[model samples]
Target: MSETDTDATATGTPDQRLHPWSWLFVLLQQLRQFIVPLLVLMFAGRGDHDAWPYAEYAEYAPLAGVLALVVVSVLQYFTYRYRIGAEGISIRSGLLQRNLREIPFTRIHNVGVHQSLLHRLFGVAEVRLESAGGNKPEGQMRVLGLQQALALEQLVRHHGSGAATTTGIAERPDGAAPAGQAEGRTLLSMPLGEVVRMGLVSNRGMLVVAAAAGLVAQASPERMMGNWLEQQVRGAAGYAEQLHLGWLGMASAALVLVAVAMAAIRLLSVALALSQYYGFRLIQTQGRLVVERGLFARLRTSVAPRRIQAWYQQETLLHRWFGRRALRIDTATGGGENDPRKLRELAPIATPAACEALFVHLLPGVQWPPAAWQGVPRRCWWRLFASSVPWTVLLVAVLWWHLGPWSLLAALWLPWSAYAAWQQAGRLGYVVDARLLAVRGGWWSRWWRMAELDKVQALQLQRSPLDRLLGTASLWLDTAGAGPLSPPLRIRFLPHAEARALHARLGRVLAARRMRW
Candidate 1:
């Protein structure tokens, strides 16, 4: 067949291999992962690379390891092959054992193209493919020619569902469709202002600093902060004592140091956010959504419509004041700290208008926090308030036994706890729309998260002893994509009658549509 005919069929006469640079990438990865062990082996057990106590073993160990790694990498490069056919893609790989992985086009949900510093320099990209039921991406092409990667990505996206198998993207004039066409619909763009907004609204910088600080402390507490920080604290106290400045002077010094640290962390966080989301863009075309962004290491992930499990809208107290929110789509493709195709950010900082447009575009016809949210009966509110009384009573009893008259102060907590519980009950509500089960929660901070009924894995009606007496029930919903540690999304304190009605309604909804996850 001609090149055009072969492309049209989504088939290649010969299997394709990764870019030759893949071996270098693999070597770097292995070295980075095992460098600590290698360093310990060299420093703790022996001298440096040039000298060792065990001249016979240590002298040849490095050479042996290097040779083995090179052999494995070469075998991997020669053995790894992927073939694209009319039905789907097949990958053949492994050095010690032979394994063939067959992935049907219909089962594929996410495709990610990553261009690192090396990939950019080499004019190649890493293309990763993931299915719905996987915790990690199943197939990855470590390196492919830039144009070829894009072509393969588009092939899976447009023709995977047999949407345009006959008139494939290869047959189209030039490369892409029109700018405003289905595949080119610009959904959201993250500007510098939005990136700044995201930075201000998130604690990622503090978290990053904390993580590094923790690692340093874990490795050597004295080297990290124990000795130096303790000495500095003692010196500050001594200086205050010498100057007759009292505790106030030491407190001021500590405050100044904390302020400086805060400013440094803030700047680092903003810079990090800007660098990560520099040119973020979300676009949709031909029933698929594609995200492209990042400054240093660019990323492009194409998400099939069927993979998305839920919509999550998060807004901190600070974020709410700016009238901007972060919107994300959770998918059942790849769930990992570095997974590009998991919680895809539709928008880092979206205005109200943008949020609505994205919501309608991503999940059309499903009303958000539906206007007809039904509140649980009034007695349910009393149950919530009463639940806090026991904890307060225990605290008050402890204070009464220990502090005598000061125990009265502990009684003050009862009213505060009851008030907080009342506020929680007031804010908590649920909306069971035809296609969605929207749960409205939070008192100090608000969150409006919803899952499609079809994606609901299990529905349970629960009743506590109090709930049984009050004729109320809690409806727990388990969505397909929920992780092991994730709490079930549910509405608490609903009337038993309504709970059963909604449970039956959920049964009907599940029956109407086929479950994908």
Candidate 2:
């Protein structure tokens, strides 16, 4: 039996409502945004009588808000309907003011299906269709039956890929391959041990801790955090005095505490990695790359190789120790580059050999880890050091005004800053060929950003007043879907004439070739 025959019926061109359980999912989604405030209201007056003057109203306000949310969800679920056609999907939604939206298959760059724990329980999933350069998703289906969602996704994917479809409906029998599992060759898969290693190599737990600390700081408007920290310090000092600890003992104790904290952080990181990357798989099928992952919530997303604009690769000291590396790509999908739904990570954690293999597979004819890197001019180091002088002077001036003699210590920053600048300039390098352009730079954590010459969207040559004096210029290559986290493909401190020549060459090449997404 066809899966679509279960709950959703495929007519020639009929409007379809979302799953019956959509309202509950919508309500849950809406509730998440107000969870913190609802929590605050729930405990507003319990601690102190004077905490809130309107405690009586606060007690019932959350309940009232929840009821309103439920009503809104119900209205939205009932009002929203979509019609599938051969070329595109038409969505009609909204409660107060009706909205009719038409999104063509060609315009949709990404199709994402997300299934959380709750969604899995009811055998439904959320679907998002993203277009290029949008502030919000083009089409969002809050909840749909898993099979129906898969069918919709398949239909969109087929139409987007320029495949000929006689009907808008997609039907799959029980023995047939599901939507995303269309006979793909597995490229990468992570087991539990590898995921654990990835967690250990990553700073996700530290980021979580920092975020929690920020939340605590934001919540404690009246210096509660400060008071708590002060109390802890006092308690530690008293204990040290009782032990008659000397400087060495105090240093050892601090080291121990730091180690303990790091251990805890690593444990938290492991748990988070397991939850996020459990059963992670990367597959290549039908000329598209597919990624599927998540523990409690599953995510499936795919992108065409031609749709990828730029590629990113990185390896930190920890990554080296773990014998792993990360690969990410910038695709033409919109909504937001930072959106978690974006399939950015091709290989979140892979061995050096595996990473190299991916480079060979994904980028045919392009060099992996360019054999020869053209370094910036030797004078670039002096230029970088000179740029730091103003900041160093500013720091010294502020410190001298505050501490007089102790400000001498701040003066030590200049030499260190110069050394750091020299190290950075020495490491900066780039490679450009007829087919590809790659740039890499870093002293400790190294990264490489590269893209095909045809993928270049814009080329810019910049020269500051200082650059003019030093006879240097910078070249920047812009591509579609560049994210905030990935550094731009820019090469700085090139000789002025070389920069101009490269810019002119790339501009001519880009002008001659037809660019894909």
Candidate 3:
């Protein structure tokens, strides 16, 4: 069923009140939290004969459970009120202490309606209201009939006027019409095909490795086997007493092969898990993006479009060959251990050109330059070369001393290191136009990022000892959201004077805009 249908029924009228069954559900949830401890107590007291130890606890169990259940039920009852006001929706909740959170009409990003298996069976659903404030989520309003969720969503949109606001800018203005409506645009959605495609393309290989690890731990064979292997290796190394060099070589080869296989299996399992967890629909609704994916426990994350601080596009050498790149957008909200809102990746990699086009379409006001800007100084090349050479020389010297003639293989590092340094130095570029500052960098996979000059939070110039000798400096541009900085974005190996010029220009732009950053 659709999300809207669930909310209406879940938020029953005041006179009607919550369904009596909801109390039971809340009680059960509270009890579930203590299930493990209860089981442990039961098992520990199974054969105990102390009258006060086990018998006294058992005697009080029923009363204690009832009191706890009642207290929680009452708390749940008061903690789960949803009301619609003329200005906005206010959800009053909290068990021990009370929390009254009001979602003003203007603050609402999107209204998310969802259903789990349990809710489905009961003809109910949960409703989530997302906002840009990045506050903790209030409890799910359980058993909302579908119609209510939809009505609330509609009501929010109707009240939230379509008037343009400066806060909603995702990209700098570029004279083109906004890609979608600012007040009420659907950002993303998934048909059944997209959902299934997401699932199928997931990397489930990692799950296998995790399962194997669990099995190995349960079997308790690692310690024994590892010790035995260690002894065999030591014996082999000192085998002049009894064994031949040929046997030692063969044993070592076998051991190395086994270790390699184990590592490969572990890596494969992790990849599989990532694929499974992240497989689902990423839809846009109003001011927020919704991500729904997971195998066992379904997750629905709502991220406000305006809260997105930065976008990162990454591609490994292999990914480039496959014509795919990974896109990551950072939002203000810090997603927790399993933060659903923090990262959204599009799998089935899109080509760099296609990815850039998609980004432009999603983020209004951002533009990709016709060609990458390349005004960086020549000193960047030498800076990169010098930084890498010292490390290369050290590694070569160490290997030559340690491995004799076999160490000649270390010579390969010099040329490869130089080539890598050149590639990295060549990739950095920056462009500043009337409305925005764009940075582009990457060797195998390129990143083209544009931010409104006004939105830059801070700018920093840094120079290492090597950078000083080369007369170059690194530039850092900070934004207001959560995400790591990138290279072209870093202004790495740019001449000191040029770096200051860019920094001053950015500062002047912010000042003209009256932006604190």
Candidate 4:
């Protein structure tokens, strides 16, 4: 049932190679993996450089690294071999051990297509075969003529259906498929303007900073940053004016640092977003929802609609100001570039109306904007206050101990915390209807989630010590799969009796329904 052409070979279809550009990819990947070790070796190989604080051969280190990468890439290109057949794929590689693997199409749950700028220049794409059962991809083709990639995808997807790809060629000689990027009917695509807005709202800057800090921490002492800051401060307040201008210099330095950090963060966030999320599109087909995105590294992931186990949409405070929300879906057979958890952004940034449309498309014949939502009990708010005030009070006390009167400003958090808790309580609610169950709640932006009874794996109604004191309970729903940020549906602070009733109702419904996988 695999997509295979009449052109036959006993070894399972003839061997295939990634596009010519694949050598560059191999080199980059190899360089990235070995960079740290290579650096360590470069430094170690100095062979005792106490005299100059550097290795005598350091000038050639970079050249040596480049040459090593070229050698590795050459070996990788010559050893890699993959064949596509009607039932599955066979991969053979490994210069020394001679590794071989045969992966069945049935075991693969996701097919991800990617095109970095290099591949695009060559009119080729990469295919990543993934299975929900593992953390790693089953196999991957570095580069294939774009059409061949699409045809191979078609062959695997419609193996049982006996359907041909758009061109009807199940297999093609490497790099021989015509010059077209495989694309499906576009279901939704963000406008460039919206893309820019989303880019502004993304927090890539913080991630970049965190990554840099982590690398620094790994490479040096933990106190290195503190010592560096002290040295800068000392240096900024020159020896002649150390006492007279110390405070002024420090204040100026602090302001400049803050301004620079903010500018860098904002600039990086926008640039990263623009580069990573340009030309984002979501397409719906007979059996798969194809998500295409990325500017430098274009990615296309195909997932089955039924594979979607749960979904939720949320808006960030920044996006909410512009009336945009992000939606994501969870799938049971989940793993790969499209694993709903990591890239919970199925719709990175779009209008609320767009989010609703996506919801309808994913779950038709289902009620949305849930008819009724009953909120948690008033004690929930009291619980919120009781839980928050102590932490805020302790924080204020700690700050006061360290900073004197200035610490009083920390108490400002108490009121703000209480206000936030109130807002959250207002948003938290539960809904139960014929076929669907939903929980609505969030802080900066409201979120509503729903799952069919058949999708629910388990239900729990339990009261914590605090809940028992408040005469309330928490209802937790365990769906078949986990989502990106949160799991199924969890409604805290439900009245005890109501929680029991809802649990029983869902339990009976789950028992009656025939679940799908």
Name the top TM-score candidate: 2
Q: CA lDDT of each candidate?
A: 0.73, 0.83, 0.57, 0.72
Q: After superposition, how far is residue 345 of candidate 4 from its true place, in Å?
A: 2.4
Better of 2 and 4 by lDDT: 2
Candidate 1 residue-wise lDDT, 107-207, digit = tens: 77888888887788888788888877657677787777776677778778877555535234345343343233345788889888888877777777899
lDDT-wise, the better of 1 and 2 is: 2
The best-first sequence of candidates by lDDT reads: 2, 1, 4, 3
Residue 331 displacement (Å), model 1? 1.5
Evaluate residue 144 in candidate 1 and report its C-alpha lDDT on the 0 to 100 scale.
74
What ordering of candidates by TM-score runs from best to worst? 2, 1, 4, 3
- Cα lDDT tens digits, model 4, 408-511, are 88888777777777888887887777867778877876677877666788788888897788678888887755744564488888788888888887777777
Q: Write the per-residue lDDT of candidate 3 for residues 1-517, one digit (tens) a residue.
A: 1121122222212311343456665676777887776666556555446745556466455556667777878767755666655455556655556566555666665455564556556655456665543555433465455444434444554455453332221131221223444434432434444333333333344566567767876787658757867998787567644556476776786788788876675456444444344445555655445566554444445555565666667766655555556556655443332444334453224456756765676666666644548656544665566667777677777988889878778778778767776786677777777766767765754565656665567788888897788677778887655443443355676778887887787777777777442
Q: What lDDT tens digits, residue by residue, belong to model 2 across residues 316-403?
A: 9899888888999998887576577888999999998898789779888877767889998766787778878998788888989889
Q: Alpha-carbon error at 175 in model 3, in Å?
A: 42
Off by over 4 Å in 3: 1-36, 51-75, 94-99, 110-126, 130-135, 138-225, 228-304, 341-348, 375-415, 444-446, 464-466, 484-489, 515-517
TM-scores for candidates 1 onward, in order: 0.83, 0.86, 0.68, 0.81
Clashing residue pairs, backbone N/CA/C < 3 A, model 2: none
Q: What TM-score number comes out for model 3? A: 0.68
